[model samples]
Target chain A: MVKQKSLRTLVAAATAALLLPASANAETVKIGVVMTFSGGAANFGKQIGQGMELFMQEHPEAFGGHTVELIKRDAKHPGGDVAKAAVRELITREKVDMLAGFVFSPNAIASAELVTQGKVPMVVMNAGTAWITKLSPYIARVSFTMWQSGHPMGTYAKETLGCETAAVGYTDYPPGKDSLNAFQTGFEAAGGKVVDAIPMGGPREVPDFTPFFQRVKDAAPDCLYVFVPSGNHAGAVTKTFADLGMRDAGIQLIGPGDITQDTELQGMGDDAVGLVTMHHYSADYDTPQNQAFVSAWKAAYGADSTPDFMAVAGWDGMAAIAHVVKTLDGEIDADAAMEALAGWTFESPRGPIMIDPETRDIVHDEHVHEVVKDGDRLKIKVIDSIAQVKDPCKALKIGKCGE
Target chain B: MADATRARERATAHVVTAHRWRWVEAAPWLVATGAFFLLPDYMTLGTQIVITVMFALSLDLILGFAGIITLGHAAYFGVGAYACGMLSAHLGWTEPVSALFAATLVAAFVGWLSGLVLMRYHGLTLLMLTLSVAILLQQLANTYSDFTGGFDGLTGIYFDPVFGVFEYDLWSHTHYWYALAWLAVVFVVARRIVYSPFGRSLVGIRENALRMHAVGAPVFRRQVAVYTVSAGIAGLSGALFAQANTFVTLDVLGFTRSGIIMIILILGGTGRLYGAFVGAIVYMVLEDELSKLTPEFWEFGVGLALVLVVLFARNGILGLLDRARSLLAERGR
Candidate 1:
């Protein structure tokens, strides 16, 4: 059995070696996508990759008279070394014009070195690390940082929703830590007091959230804030809170929108209803810009659709770059691309957003949403808007973009 | 008495033949050195291969020679990586050589303590124990994010120039040569240990623990010692990797890493130290390159190759090479 498996593996590998597509032609515009297609955060990169592919399909002439090709390279492991090598290979061997698609912040941080060394204009799609954009002159971000997404919720909770005392619960990891801190910083800045701040330490595959929710319930604050990741497991956080009967007690559930992720809230039934959260995108955030994107994406993928934050991120990224390419008329200029992208405003599915070239982060309207149980299904309803919120690093007294 | 004499005579003849071709043992190191000079452009890839080669070599000692089956050998690997990483980033221990050495000893001590409990079990329970220990270590590292960097990984950790003379450069050839030299040293030590009387007794224990213990082999103590040695080598490999990349993540101590290294050992053939060299090169290069083509389904290719190697080449690539060498000699004759 082992020997058979071995030969089959070798033959397949040999076939891949044979099918090595020739490197990027000098004439065409090549966008090297260095990302993790296989790992813990694979979906983050995959959605971005798909979004670009979809954009390329919609506008065949994306780069103004040039044949554009997206060469995707898996970072395999996000241990910095792999990302560096992948980016190097793309720049030197593939001769790609630009680079995009970084989901893991560590991978982005690592690839940042290569972007500086190789001098490739790298467009970051979705890595929320605060200092990622500060890596290189050639680097720019098309996605919101964790702080940008979470801080608005804190401000909204305090001033808009009239919540004075709140409880914050989050996983004990980097993104989780960053989200919790961003919320606390923004909440405290807005004159709100945190009654209880709890972190769920250890790994993600916890069988029970009963004990964690019990602690939050015990605090009995005006609002309960949670920070869980987005994906299949996101819905379970709300389901757990619902099962614990926290919502029935009238301590309104508010979280970093990942807990009620677009793709997941539908399957969560009524468990996530009235769950208020904030993120970069809410597909139900009715706008002419959103309608076109939601309709087009739904038309392609099917009607039962909710644009994942990752997918929206991917769509916005491609759209921003395409706008740059159109202005430049087939040439990829690093300075010009950065200049054009800086004040470049585009209608994203979320709403209108402009690229902040100084910080290289998106300046977008943060959607304050409510997960209303629409009959038998759950969907996000845009209840309020946080207008033109800049990157929340400015909220930090000493954070990356802060004074 | 006559049959025993005949068996002894065959063993003596076998030893003589192996000694006559002993220079072949230097083949991997010599080839790697040549590649280091010839393939300057591929130093990064070479560095990764050398690290993985060293990692699989350590596994070869325990599972191959000493017959200790483990599913979480990466626990030691992760320990060594984080130990070196934290030492470099937090404590300013920038000298790669001494930091790696100290980290190896730490990993060995951990292995010794764990071996005390693990040596009592034999099969699935033993597997579960090692796996749980690995998971525990990973969680502890993750939970204490302040120290471990918690998922963002241990970044900004770098090694000083070799002897403070050879500057760390763009191509990372310094890292490649350093790793390659350490690999040579580790391989030699492993060779010396495995060829000793203690190694033969380890094999005896593996074949039948009851008989070896009854014969006063101190089976449990021997197993623990070999486990510690193997763990030290794994830790060294991890330290080298951490130093070369200047970054370490929880993934280093992950379950998948343990599984991959085991497969590399098996695919190269067990009980053969040199097999690690052969298996890692084929596996790592195939993974690094082919993954560029089909990012999503490349593992399918890796899985298929492993299954084939196991089914047909039971002794692995080394065994296949041996058969080819003998076949070439026969054809020449």
Candidate 2:
């Protein structure tokens, strides 16, 4: 009788061990992440990943009753159909409750489709194509869209700087086209004229940009507006612009959000000093939340690793997801989480983010900043803030933005 | 008795000849084609297999049958993709027509121009030249964004129905069938070419280029013609890809795109049409599965699998299956 009882107890213990959740061993909410880990866009993805990691480390087990597990996949450069295919695998096969981290617009767009199809809530950190908010109900962007930054930059150029004519040069993809289009709309609305718009395709790894610079020079606009993402490409473009002595041509270089975030522009030295851009969450933003985020991020990643806009966005996105998951006891039901997110207001490092239920777009403030030399490091000084800018997709009647 | 023995020997010789012909003939290819089309129910998987098979057939003409090694095949693929995208976006040409025009003209033009450089070199030099061409095209596409739409790509594109039938939708089921049909046609065409005199010359060159040149085979011309044809087919695949997805990004020109296609070819077993199909299907399925397991660490598994195949199986999975069948036959005997 004693032997039988002991055997029964051992069997019961084994059964319990087998049935225990995998998280009981590690105890983290597994997040399947796809990003440009091994490509030209890798820097942006790395920054975002770092930011998310920082947040997770700081608030371990903050989401309900589970710890968070972040699994990253590198979507190599020029991923094309492969990236979309990867997203499908991440969502359907991985069964991740939530999807996040795509720095490039195309990757985000593709992943957004899968997220909607899988009925999973996605908080897109970076890759502001405007299509994410417009196309899918499943997608909630924490990052500013191209137009969100471009429109304000245009407004600043006209209202603050008193610029009359501007020459626009941007890569000719969805993000670039969207940014340029928004700049045109806002600049023209403010009674400013764009002299010449030159669209350059991106991922530029060339030695010479003499021809592109010459064209911009010939346009003879008072200010030059260029949007080139990726640090290597920015370095090349800035170098070429400096080499051609375009600054003396009376063309003050103005860029969209990407310009200030790029570390490579620091190499442009004095040439990048007077450059102005419109973005959210510059490192110089003076707030307790911002300072804490910056200090933690720097401590974790290192002092040399300055956080980009995408990092801030990613940190906020993780926080938002955590907030919803905590509310739902770590069971991320799509409808419940989305309802929780709609009209959801959160205090982030970038002040307050109010999710507009009508547009499903994060209606927030944009800041116009100028590059200033803060000792040896380059920092953005926020000169003005453009508040409550409406969703551009709603205005353009493109995709399903109104829904 | 002697007469009977002679007759028996003749019968044996005839049987041997028939068996040899069967070994070298069309039965294996026919079986492979049937199996390739029949497998894979998922639209994405099916479409990927079809596209990759088409890409392999294009390479087979140059590398397998002909004596050419190209590391820059993605150049023509990108050109076709960009051309088709630009045409459909600007002119709003129907999908099939635009795809056909783009694949044939743009791919052929780029092929011919690049051929001038490619033909000047052989072996490693030719490989390097092709790589440079592909990289240059990718840069040009990125640097001149006004046309190519840059890194974000030309999105929100809609394609008209295929010949007024079979609408291309985002779900990609119809596109899969369309691509499969195209693959069948290209396979048949490739088979026909492989049996032709031109194909004989190509084989001769691949076997011994110096001897073929001595025999006045016009080796350079043959190489150029095969390269152009291969480029055209690759272009066709790229155009189909763009049309099917309704999106074309600059990544089509990236070196990794070219490398992945090459890897698919190697995984499927080079020099065989069915190899590409089988390889693409298996690679995609594995990727789909592994990514679910561990999104970051899946590549390690894939890399390990590739290494194992390279070390243990010389002829890939298909070859291993063939070996297994022969071993079974020996056991039965």
Q: Pick the candidate with the highest lDDT.
A: 1
TM-score, each model?
A: 0.90, 0.76
Model 2 ranges off by over 4 Å: A1-31, A60-62, A66-71, A172-174, A199-201, A206-220, A235-251, A262-270, A327-331, A396-403, B1-50, B75-151, B154-192, B207-229, B239-246, B263-333
- Candidate 2 residues A1-403, lDDT tens each? 1223211111111222245552344223456666775534557776787777677666644454455556566665544476666665556455678877777777776556566777878777877777566657887878878878887778778888888999888775566777788888778889899989986754354435677779889888877888876465566666678888888888788878676664554665665677778877777788898889888888987887777677888788878777776677666788888888888877778778877786567777787778788888676788888777766656666543444
For residue A170, model 2's alpha carbon misses the true position, in angstroms, by 3.2
| DockQ metric, candidate 1 | 0.31
Model 1 C-alpha lDDT per residue in residues A68-135, reported as the tens digit of each score: 56777888765666887778778766777789888888888777767777777888888887777776
Model 2 CA lDDT for position B210:
91
Q: What C-alpha lDDT values do all the predictions have?
A: 0.79, 0.72
Backbone clashes per model, in order?
A: 21, 9
Off by over 4 Å in 1: A1-26, A39-41, A60-62, A201-206, A304-306, A323-340, A398-403, B1-7, B16-23, B33-40, B320-333
TM-score of the B chain in each candidate versus the native B chain: 0.94, 0.85
Docking class of 2: acceptable
